[model samples]
Target: MLVVTTACNLDCAYCYEGGGNGQGEMMDLDTALRALDLVAASNQPFHVQLTGGEPLLAGELVFRILEYIRNNNLPATTAIQTNGVLLDHQTARRLHSFGTAVGVSVDGLPAIQEQLRGQGAATWKALAMLDSERVPFSVTTVLSSRNTRDLSTLGMALHSMPAASAIGLDLLVQKGSAAAKIGVQPPDAVTIRSGVTRLLATLDVLNAQRSRPLILRERQTVLKALGRDEARPYCQACTGSSLAVTPRGELYPCTQTLGDARFHLGTLDHPRLSGTALPDGRLPKREECAGCGLQGRCPGDCPSRLHYNGADGAGLVCALYRTICDYCLYKGEIPS
Candidate 1:
């Protein structure tokens, strides 16, 4: 179940939903409840992420929706993706009571963070509140040229947070953000390699100190590093494994396609997808993967992002992904 609202208090440079300054519609509580009902009937133990231009911008609507889901016996793991700019003691307390795990987006330490994510003071306050409330949380940082230099610094910030359970290295996806509109591309192959190498080394240092391991590229990074034989998780966009519903109750496969009318799945209350099969169907045909020896494990790259970027065939990131996969596969992470 995806709840969407086009309201936010911060002007983060990397925001994908295009929400800030209250531009989208606001769904009523009844509509949100109906969506929950549909999810419960699907029999898919899916996560119900409360997302928005900023979900909290809808006032107590988030709490109410969570309460309804729990009370109705719907099976869901509730999560909230917040910039942490608007979080307060009272709000944090209510969210914690609902068992809604929080994932706060922070780019780096104060200097770089303020450049990437606004309302620095508020973000810090929210992190402190989460810590005081003992709320299990993860900090997400978007890597970029402007901030990539701060990977170790950001790691240090997270390492200092005893309340943080994990850190997600969100490599910037150049699409909707000002970065892309202004012609900013993702780091080149050389840069990706150097940045990832730096990130991995820094994480090792932090791990040596007993801090939680940072999660980047998730299964791909982990499996390859450990030399395991596990297949990489299919891209979220391709499988429709995830969906994003807008504030007006419109459904999208993922947040990346939220505003694109073509990707609309269905209304939130109805919670049924419309149109052709989602990109997920592209999987299972190993031979179609274009000479990718790791196709069995990597599936294909994220179809949603590919469609969004107007890319065809293998992607720029695919080459790097295969490199990681091959390194891991031969290294015994996957037990050939």
Candidate 2:
């Protein structure tokens, strides 16, 4: 995931990239080119996640990077995670032509969304434009206290969006600034389970009448989580395997680890010195993982649940994990 630039226009309360306060020279074209070159040389396939404080805030740089990919014919599936507020007609056209999938960070309805994003109708305007242009996109709702009670309501709203293909529910973000700024906390396990249940229930109702209900990717992921044996590194958090390149050419295993010098793998010019980045951060292979009766074929991936207990996630999350699996399976979202 190339963190193209960290300079976002929105000052989201939960702005994880230090409120976009430290874009730090804002990723020069040279740095971006060199990073792309390195990826091309790897002879490996990757989906380039264009992220930012708000990537559209750096529109020119984004276009140039896309142009580079087209010119070189890089075997990369590209997508941009944008706030959608800045997705004007021209920008939307360029993105469609570039074959870049758009992921919008919209929390919920106007009052609910404005409470967190502070942009209100402007964000929705972008969503509308995408629909008008017939641009394919998805909605990423950061489920917060403001919208938690209305999970089903939010799901229904997303259902009405014209060009949106899926709904991504990030019930909460990190615990630092977002919590303090928005007066929000990560929903507890019980709260999370309830929200998912509510969301699935919403989908159930939709699928009942509509021949094709919109997909909730998180539900499918949770089912996969219920069946796991061996440990794989969490999605983009794995060292070296999944990477986030900073604007200044520095590298991190995941975008969440950006700004912290500890996870700073290295800069593009000196990537060989990234050995210190991992520092034995692998998930522990515990007895719970090894001895569980339905292990490998059950609860797949949950770095958050595991990290909730710190290094002792296996011991801490066992009962809660089982309860979730039971609940989801009973709902028939997961096949028996």
Compare the candidates by TM-score and give the number of the best one.
2
Error of 1 at 31 (Å): 1.4
Worst ten-residue run, lDDT, model 2? 300-309
lDDT of each: 0.64, 0.68
Candidate 2 segments whose C-alpha is farther than 4 A from its true place: 20-24, 171-176, 179-182, 208-212, 225-231, 273-324, 333-336
Kindly list the per-residue Cα lDDT of model 2 for residues 123-229, writing each as its tens digit.
88888889889897888877555665667777787666657778876534353365364565554555555666677778778766654567777656556655554
Question: Local error of candidate 2 at 246, Å?
Answer: 1.5
Error of 2 at 285 (Å): 10
For all candidates, the clash counts are 8, 14
> Which 10 consecutive residues of model 1 have the lowest summed lDDT?
280-289
Reference-based TM-score of each model: 0.82, 0.83
Q: Which regions in candidate 1 have their CA more than 4 angstroms from the true location?
A: 183-185, 211-214, 217-237, 268-277, 281-296, 310-316, 319-336
Highest-lDDT candidate: 2
